[model samples]
Target chain A: MRPILISCHTRPVIAVKFNKDGDLFFTGSFDGKVSVFWSEPVERLGTFACDGAVKTMTVTEDSKYIVIGTAINGIFIFEVETGTKVKTIEFSSKIHVRDVEFAMGSQQFFMISYESDEKKQSVVYIYDFESVLNREQPSRRDLVRRDRDHYYRGVWGYLNKTIVLGTQNGIIDVVDTKTGELLLSHRAHVNQITSLAFSPDFSMLITASRDCFAKLLDPETLKEIRVFNAQRPLNSAVISPLMLNEGSPKYHCLVAGGQEARDVTTTATDQGGFEITFYNMIFEREIGSVRGHFGPVHSVAVHPRGHMFVTGSEDGTARVHILDQDYFTPAYD
Target chain B: MADADYIEREHIEATADGTYKITTHIKIQNKTVITNPDIERRKTLPKFGDCKNLSKGDIEGSINIEDKEVFLQKSSQVRAEENITKFNLNRAHKEKLDALTRRERAIMSGETEEQKTRRPIVTEREEFSVKVSNLPDNIDQDVLQNLFGTAGRVRKVFIPRGRDDNLPRDFAFVHFDTKAEAEKAIKQFKDYPLGHHILSVEMADRRNQRRNVPMSNRRGRK
Candidate 1:
């Protein structure tokens, strides 16, 4: 499918997400702004400007509040209906939060923060939404500081059951959020892991890294199921949300975005740009490629309906692409 | 006696011409801010008397240089050298010059709020930095620079990265040339919208320093 709608941001779009129903989508830019739009009507609903860069944001499952994490500003909780900020929780002045995710159907959320200390290690902190609404003095419940030896890169909280973190040296740690216990840790890649995503069923995990490869692994055992060498530094990888039925034919596709080979130079005039590559998960081969961004692509999010996906780039804009009709309608022999 | 008198006029004409040349050389030196090679050549001469012993071609050759291409080339060379010399000033000197020029211009033009805002935010390691968070992810360095542009010249915008992610970790360090400008930004940009997100701005704590803290010493809690 072609890009039917194009929206522009004044700065690099860092995060693009579709709401739970796929009816509303929000795009966040480094300029510290968030824009909400109605998906079907393609109309801008409201915009909230933060004090710092809008690094990560999530709408709680109940859709009552939109939680935003700014670069240094702090965590903001806004009422979804009135667009009024309800509460703000700040742990530090200069928090380098990597990711923020709300646990499924829960008020608790988890975030990974990178500290500038000597070892450059990172930690995972969990907070309760009720704390902010309650105007509590201390809202953060658990702070899991990683050891100095391992530097954390990316993080994701799954079903309120586990918080998974990817380290710089390529190890993935699965921890129990409630107990603050590391349930599992395994070396997942040769280099630093940049992003991690799970399939619709949550049975398979996909990881992309600086090592130039994205691998699919079983979430339970963390075993490598398939690997695709992108031959370039990858920033994000996402599995399509089409795999709903367990017995249905596996038509899910993997979408990845990052710098292309020979385009690593940071010069403005350099012929370096990023590409969004799509692959068939079952076949493990690239199916298509889309290129337009003038800089490295940083993040990608698939529409919950699996008909469209969005990608954010260092070039300061996000693009939404619709999947070709043929992919969804599989060819039956 | 007549021959001696003729020689005297020649000497006097040359001396007068030499004096004129010296004045012109000084003027050019001050205007261009370059040390001309011709000035150095004149320095080596024992006296103006030495110039008279030269042949007519020598006399015409030196004077005619003003109309020739060689002088143009020499002036261009001087211009390049002047540029290099100006570029080599120490940081403190450069900053002083910048501040002076800015102040002079501000006085002459009258201070607009925008002009009043332009100051250096990051002067040293931790002095003039403002911590900015909640920035929209789409905003890049240029947008960030423009967002803080009102406060002054942002020395640098440090967007901290995760260990591997290409996008910055959620927050950034905005360094100004001076603490005053940074503090001004904290006041002005509080809850400013950069794009879709409103920014959270504050004077960074001294403990909130640029990268390079020892890993073990990195205190993440509280």
Candidate 2:
């Protein structure tokens, strides 16, 4: 069969995340649909859509099942092959969710809920699926919900121990993934916190948002190490997970893409368009700009190994580009 | 414009290379208009062909889509004429109509009206148009001759086809030689009781008066 066009009336796909082996990728659309596209051989045209457009997808460190946080419809865990809808968690009390992720190397997962009940009364729920992974009888314990009005959007796990979450009101909460204990919560950005990603080493953390800047923060001290003013409001920034692989010796840069036009309606005419700027992850200064797409460049994914990676757009095309170090090349440094 | 409201197509002509002449005379009528190959279906129905023996337009200075009053007046005469089922093919058509109407839903599904050619009929006649909407999409001239041939002597059955899309129009217009025979067809098929599709029959417009629509709206009418 040919690829048929499918569109969700709500939102265009904003973020798509592939599982560890890249066999399945979860796509989250603005339409509140978080769908999984699984390719038996990781091939195109073999891609099939799951029921919803998921915003983000994270796999357990062992690459077993994926946990995706959705809008309105709640979170869904898919078994992938036979489309077995393994587990679903919903607070249904009109709690909207912005981001979802699982703990590093842990079978359990964490979800962030919105301030639905009260004007600012909010909570983040962590559902433990340790038994599901252990195969006790195909089920796990119910979720442990945390009420925190300060926590907002981004969440991640690092070093198989620390859980890092960024909130909508510009706060970053660092919690212990093992005990579900809150470790650190700091206002990282000046505006709404868009996303957070930890360097593969788990030592350095990155956050960006409508504040028009991307900052590298030390997860331990909760202090901004370096601040770089991006050309546009940064939506998302991701560092390569396999940075410095094979001991290439090049400075693995922290690259970010941001929206220039600033508005959605007149996105078509913006010539300089959206900018994908690169920076040395450690030194943190503007390196260069990558251009082409016409709308808000929303998300970035550094490919696992090679210098090639992709960035998604509101203009409807996700661009994959080749990036290598510059100024002080690997040979010079 | 009111006088020229309804028109039907008789035929189209072209030059040797299939190009048409500058100005062609068309036949037009409402009640009992006479038309043959020579005139156009229009306001000024020229005096020509089988139409030579009668006045050009109806005495009411009007044309009705269906002459129900006329059909009512001559209904008995038509029924008596239908009793003469000359050709066996027509008897077969009658049987088919019976079969189709019995299977109601089947006619509605998988059966589409040929967008191009409807059974030929005078326009604005609900009885004529609606009945044709019910018939089989692809009935040819022979089948029509058999089906409607009961009312009178079937001289010709014209199924107008679209020049482009080629979708068949569901109705077929049939002409008979005599007024009594034409009236007989109107009486028999006017209600279109068979096959869920009953056809409407009427005195054919003289060839010039055969108009499917207004000259401006009608294709091939420069």
Candidate 3:
């Protein structure tokens, strides 16, 4: 059990992000909007909107620009301080870029697209943003298309040492970033794995699945360190990286977004009703629970400072909350 | 090795022009002026059903609930003078009767609140409820929810709040979304012993008597 952060509202959360400073976090949902909030006060600093459902978000290592992924397959780069749209990346209709990450050192970034079908085939496209924009036919082709059997959902590129790939099979495959080769594959749940995160210090990889299991795994070898099967399906989980700070940065928390297993009769998982839950790893207990949505919870992203997190869910809501070790508090700023 | 594979010229269509005919090209008309909605730059968090909203917009609330057979069966027969369409009525009359009464605000709201308080207390979803009984003076809601959590899609599974040495009744109620789920759970757990007590998993008491149930045998509402 460990301390974690959670957020909930009446809408389905589509994406969540921790700004570079860890001082602020952002969230977007099906409602076609995004919000920035102060971690400590939990106040809304600003709000923005995209063309459609914001599917994913990636805050550059420098935190200069935030890349927002929309269900319409368009990526918008927004300035952190000014809340301005700096650039736009568009994809052809055939591809839906579901997740994106800025590699270590912020030299390049990667985006993965999930094809909505039973095959659940996907592609991994790597790019050096500035370098690719210089090309005449910039969107000529993807850098690499993943193989068929290796279906991937979420990607976490930490220090370029570990590449965490979540699969539709509820497994987390940690690959060596240097070699682009598989290092470890752990079956973390009985349902499709929805989201994963790597700690800032690169010691932990958190995995969440529709089977209701939120797991903490050893980042290096992908060993299952702890499993919190709340008996509730989850869509995504993100771990706060600032825990490595010696000053007791106040968070080593895991946030899971998902819902109660639907069709409990068939019990096939992916039932989709969910709550954003905070787990205290050291205590091995759930410290806080935020409930509001009527659908599945999807993503949880902590602010860089380890104080608060923004969560997304299928019910079309995104919520933000602050962490109070003594208890969980709502930061309504 | 020469004859192992004979490639046909037509099998692979060779392109002869600057670009293939099937090339994906974006045809753009030169525009002297551009016009679009100047909504917020962040395309998220719009008001429910705002024009700029994306995806399916917000959910329609809990207005749409699917009713399976078990939900109807366990709902009880209404027993006496109820306003619902009586059984043995023809299908057409039943439909008309249901449609007419569902329009009545008083009747409509009457049942909803009852449904909300589902179990004696709030659990997960309203359709299901769980309560515990016969504990040796000590037990908790955690013991009950965890006990029935693995059974099926638990809407709400918890032990109803009790008083000193008193039980919520010597029984627990486990509510599930679908009657099939409830039935599945009953087959697997009913009559099974949880410590010293035999669990009787059955359809919830009829909706009509749920309130008056305070007079029931064991943990009747005081």
Candidate 4:
């Protein structure tokens, strides 16, 4: 894999997400902008200015809309093609919007709100896009209330049926999206379960935790299959998208990155930079690592084509890695 | 009331532009203040009922004992023997009950000691607690216990959980046997990297010391 450094954000890059087509990717930064880039050409397409530093962001599967959230600024929904502001959602300014995830194959999106007011603290809400497009106030349903002691940082919709929330207590709370009934709750790690990424077939689920362990688990039973130790506090982990009929051995590989467990400073010159570890699902061993960022890696996203991945780091850069070596070599030749 | 007897009169002639002439007269009547001890004593008693006799009991009765002895000598001898046997039986039963109670108490105390050994010995000393912030999530209890144990005998390490999530909020209160030990830990571990973050060591604020302040609810872009 070859790394291409993208130095667009002036501050720490918090989020990196690729659209379904894999032609475009988005990077949100604490510099108060969400930069869009053409993946193949690796050129900056445009940048959207937010009211405050972007904390989290997501683009729809069809790439029709982009939703960005900030700590002080309200959530903004924009039409991707026209780059026009679609809607502005008003929430308590005290809230730190942590996760913005567009639902798979739907016009609905889920957002995890944290550090909010007492009335709506640590809540995950599902908002309908059709309502926002109609210029009407979007209808929302509260999927989970993570008040006080039950804070959740990550949420993903499983099979578009149930919503799975990764809690601060290292537990996963599976809730029925329609009925809002709690189906199951189990501890996935010892510390905060930071992120959850599901496989393409929806069979195996991977979880990253601040406990320095990334685990492969059965989504239905929430049973641990294997543990990949990172020896650091992982903030994000993503499973590579399935390679279509390619028969590539690297399909469904896990890439996880986060803070160094020992080195506390952000500007250490030694082996102190953030590390991205890759694990092969078939071989069940760490296959490789990516290290370049001077600060801790905050997030990682895999392209839909599974040829490349994007990683956002606290060092204010989002790096693009082309996973298929042949794709780059053929071009150089 | 203080006694006063006097008559005073004042007159004012009307000016040319004044409405009317005015005359005023003041008189004080002779009066005497009551200083009897009986009135003050009566005022202190309850007002609803008879003050002195209300506490006294009215009903009284007593039964007189008959001098006649119905039992003959043989019956009386049997009764006396029965009474002695019943008294001895009651005494023995009471003694046995006392012994059993004492044994139960001893067993309970023994169980308490066992429980004390089984339970974690966390000393309740708020003064000797040092607050440590920026703790990495992966750092387990044993690591913290060993780290803080070097300073002095750490009584307990309490990581405050979020109100709803039950997750440690990246800070812990380490209590030592003495304030000196807590101070030592603060001096040693301050700004040192324990896990993923540099430790911010300080004295812990008292429980509930943070007052509830209203958060600003300003919405939308300025």
Candidate with maximal lDDT: 4
* Runs of candidate 1 exceeding 4 Å displacement: A5-7, A117-121, A149-158, A245-250, A260-273, A331-333, B1-222
Candidate 1 lDDT at A102 equals 79
Task: Give per-residue CA lDDT, model 1, range B16-43, as digits (tens).
Answer: 4364322211111225556645323422
Writing each residue's lDDT as its tens digit, candidate 1 over A21-126 gives 6766778888877776555434455566677888888887655678888877787777654467777777566457777877777577787777666656677877
Model 4: residue B62 alpha-carbon error in angstroms: 99
Local accuracy of candidate 3 as per-residue lDDT tens digits, A130-156? 654455344423533454534446565
lDDT digits (tens) for residues A149-253 of candidate 2: 355565565554666766555667777655667777565555667778777677777888666667788878878787655545778776666555656544444
Q: For candidate 2, what is the lDDT?
A: 0.54
Which window of 10 residues has the lowest lDDT sum in candidate 2 chain B? B63-72
Model 3: how far residue A227 lies from native, Å: 1.3
lDDT for position B208 in model 1: 49
lDDT assessment of candidate 1: 0.65
Go through the candidates in order and give each one's DockQ.
0.00, 0.00, 0.01, 0.00
Q: Provide candidate 3's TM-score on chain A.
A: 0.78
Tens digit of per-residue lDDT, candidate 4, span B130-179: 88889998567678899999999987676656657656678877867778
Candidate 2: list runs displaced more than 4 Å.
A1-11, A22-26, A31-42, A45-53, A130-150, A157-160, A178-182, A260-262, A267-273, A322-333, B1-222
Worst 10 residues of 3 chain B by lDDT: B67-76
